[model samples]
Target: MKRKSWMLGVLFVLVILVSYMAKPEKTQNDLLLMNIEALAAGEDYVPIQCIGTGTVDCPLGGKTKFVMIGYSLE
Candidate 1:
């Protein structure tokens, strides 16, 4: 019983670790939405723009430009 419980605990931890590591990194849109949310909450926000070709301008303002690597807008 004790060994079974230990194995279960280890399995649970490994599962959690693998899931965390496999999680996708936040995208530009995600960060933009977060900034918008913060702005809605009366917090200061500096808008960012996309610098590469086929880039979409930030709705808020063009304060900073960023290139979304490995992402294409279709």
Candidate 2:
């Protein structure tokens, strides 16, 4: 009985961990919406000026490690 309970507890923990790990990461659209919301909230917004296949110098100034796959305006 005790061994069975122990195995069930382990299985429960594993399910929780797997669920957490399998959670979908935020997508570009999500990020864009967040940025829009931030802008509407009167927060500072630093738009991405440019993107490259790899790290490249931003036209604004410093270097950036962004590779923009797609973008949408409003």
Candidate 3:
């Protein structure tokens, strides 16, 4: 019974770890919204890649690692 309980506890921990690891990171749209908010607040915003063009080589590509900014605006 003690061994079974220990195994169950280990399994529970593994399940939790896997679920946490599989969670998706913040998306490009989320970053863009934050950037827009910053812009509205008159603060400098980090540039993001243009998602509309489906390319990371957009002008603002040099600013951030994610593609949150628009192509034309860059």
Q: Considering every candidate listed, which one attains the maximal lDDT?
A: 2
Q: List candidate 1 segments past 4 Å from native.
A: 30-74
lDDT of each: 0.67, 0.72, 0.68
Tens-digit lDDT track of model 3 for 1-74: 99999999999999999999999996678889888988888635555445454434556443333355534432
Best of the two (2, 3) by TM-score: 3
RMSD of each: 16.9, 14.6, 15.8
By TM-score, the candidates rank as 3, 2, 1
On the 0 to 100 scale, the lDDT of residue 40 in model 3 is: 86
Q: What tens-digit string does per-residue lDDT give for candidate 1 at 1-74?
A: 99999999999999999999999997678889888887788624444445644445545445335543343343
lDDT score, candidate 1? 0.67
Number of the top-ranking candidate, with TM-score as the measure: 3
Please list all clashing residue pairs in model 1, or write none if there are none. Answer: none
How close to the true structure is residue 69 of candidate 1, measured as C-alpha lDDT? 37
Stretches of candidate 2 off by over 4 Å are: 30-74
lDDT of 2 at 58: 69
Ranking by lDDT: 2, 3, 1
